[model samples]
Target: KYVPIENAKYTLTERFVDEEGNEISPSVVKGTDYEEGSEYDVTGDAKVIDGYYLKETSNTTGKFGKGDMTATFTYAKLGKIIPVDPEGNPIPDAPTPQYPNNPTDPGKTTPDQPVPEIPGYRPEVPSVTPTDPGKDTPVKYVPIENAKYTLTERFVDEEGNEISPSVVKGTDYEEGSEYDVTGDAKVIDGYYLKETSNTTGKFGKGDMTATFTYAKLGKIIPVDPEGNPIPDAPTPQYPNDPTDPGKTTPDQPVPEIPGYRPEVPSVTPTDPGKDTPVKYVPIENAKYTLTE
Candidate 1:
């Protein structure tokens, strides 16, 4: 018969699926039909006829999720109903022994989630205390593009020049939009970088910052004692020869790091002379002396 959400009654099946694609035959669920709707929701263990009513629903029927553990009850009417609880009980231990319905999906347990042991493992989680502000945490960031590796490639370019992708520490570290790494760069340990002063960074991080500037690193292109071209070193763009087009190094004329200075006020006699405070200073270059 058709039933409403409240004051509802429905039947369920007894046979179910076991994990590993096996079939499971469950004992039938036996219960009297309770009306569906809001009155059914008396949460927690309440004494029903035989088992505990574990839910707040009026209807005697329940639904199940896939791969979840469920309890099957053989209704006294020779029918079945699924309950949220895994332990199937025909009669409530206590009247209205209630918990919510369908705690988990049936037959959907994965290989990893074995049937939980009676004494389950429960770890204690520490509570966060707002009053404890005395702790400190360290931070470090490493980028993937900065790492270097040896690769086999063709020795000649389309113009019969060489195509090399050699990188150096500090020297070729690309300055991307996200990080501000303006440093007096120095090459160190293979392909990594650190600031000349307080600079901080990871080795082999960031992109090939100066793929265009590789020719500037003179020592990379090796030669025999007689200065013959190394078999793979392409005829450098600078060609290490003063006569070559690269009369300058890639990082050359590196424009000085920009500086910032607060704007001078009009200094009118009627204005708040020497009393106004600057809201902000964009560039903090403390090296240069101010005349005002």
Candidate 2:
């Protein structure tokens, strides 16, 4: 009884094996079968080997159902991985993959191929290059020729203290690219970003430094006649004249303490170009002398 199996199909599996013949889990193609002239697409599933890159090999595509055919892809080992911070600062502790899996061979050392995912950091694709052919003995793998940029966010208080290690906002521009400074600044707690430099201009050009200036909340300190801070002084308020609908009146009477009279009956607050103005109030009391 020599009856051929109807539509009998042979299994076509693509196995991605490392240099040591160990199969990479991600590289393994799901088991599929095809009859003669039946189409089998591995285009989407084919992945570049890790720690190695695709080379200019002769074989890329072919017909299916050639009797359990095996397609082997060639890859070059990676030599280096140069990781940089968002500000283009080099991260020295970045992982480096070994060449020929050897530690002693300096010529074979290359940067790791995988870009590390650090929270609040944006990583760029790494540049790759083959080992120098001029070396005493040519290496088998390619190395990271240029370091990739990983942008990190920055945040600080008015006093230059670190408030947050990163910014929640994102910028689309790359290093050396012109950035617009006209956009509104990100809001921070208890502080306002001062426009010390050009607020509406291109960055990386003349007087176009992207500098952020944070100003703390305004304060009015009441001092004694001896120029010492007074205890329990009334806090000054800005735009204090609530009666005026326009809120243009900046004069607000100094708060009355049981024993003190203001040197001036009313103090006018000064506008420091902030959302709110600060007013300094000096009070004179016959019971206790107060100074500015």
Candidate 3:
């Protein structure tokens, strides 16, 4: 008599995934049908993958039972170490080190990464610790206490034109350090310091500038055609307000002289360090009139 035999079907599905259950590599599947009482071993780890390592496994070694079985292998992708500022922005030109793909122990930190040196800034942490795969480790950097800055001194006239040479001093002081540019202002001839802008302040992240605005202090002198001072010519006084752009002096009326008529009725000074001429010509005698 022929005996009826029962058979068992089992499926071994090997999956490579990350901690977040995302597959890093393709799945390997195999299936077989065996006798109900047959013993089978079909689950194991997968091959090495670039930039990924075995993290955990399920059903590494299991017997083929009446029901289907599925096995899986999870992996962890190496993480990257990034340098950043205090605001969490990535630092420019900074090195980004990656964690070892096959660490001796999973979920543990890898070797410390070297922190790059940044000019005028200090790293908050000397080194970086690379942790869990697929995550970034940030190294913060802050401004150094002794960082130097530049200060520019400018002496300009009311029209914003430089009256004196500009002084540029770089890498002189640290941030927030107080500085005084009052003494640096020059004593320019025919001009006086009217006001100042950003002349005195504490240094900051950007370059500092000190502008000393000056106004012209000029006078008017009257002279003759021979380039000699006019005898008894009234001196025109400059206006008291130096901020005036015209820099005009009060008009001076011609003085009365015997047997002379002044060339001009009045004289007005227009330019600084310049002379305005006023001539006195001899008057001609008028012929006597005979008519009644």
TM-score of each: 0.13, 0.33, 0.36
Task: Report model 2's TM-score to 2 decimal places.
Answer: 0.33
Best by the lDDT measure:
3
Error of 2 at 193 (Å): 3.7
- Candidate 3 Cα misplacement greater than 4 A, ranges: 1-11, 18-23, 29-48, 53-56, 59-62, 86-89, 92-95, 103-109, 116-126, 143-292
Order of quality (TM-score): 3, 2, 1
Q: lDDT tens digits, residues 1-292, model 2? A: 7765677666555555455555553444344576666655554444544455433222234565545544544344555444555555555444443333324332233433345433224455543333541122211222222323322334456565655454433333333444444353555544545543344343221112334555554444555556565677765534322332112244445556556544655544454323332233443444665789
Give the per-residue lDDT of model 3 (tens digit) for 1-292: 9564455455666777877988877887765554444564543346566677666777756666566666677777666777777898987666676666544444344566667676556788787666556677877888676777788888898899998888895557777788877766566666656788887899765467889888866544455546566666565544442444324445656555555566788766655434556676656793444667
lDDT against the true structure, per candidate, is: 0.25, 0.43, 0.66
Candidate 3: residue 1 lDDT (0-100): 100
Error of 1 at 224 (Å): 99
Candidate 1, 174-269: lDDT as tens digits: 333232233323232111221122123332322223222112222222233344433543222211223322222232111122242223322111
Where does model 2 exceed 4 Å of error? 1-155, 159-179, 183-192, 195-211, 235-249, 269-292
Instruction: Order the numbered candidates by lDDT, best leading.
Output: 3, 2, 1
Worst 10 residues of 3 by lDDT: 240-249
Candidate closer to the true structure by TM-score (higher is better), 1 or 3: 3
RMSD of each: 26.9, 18.6, 22.6
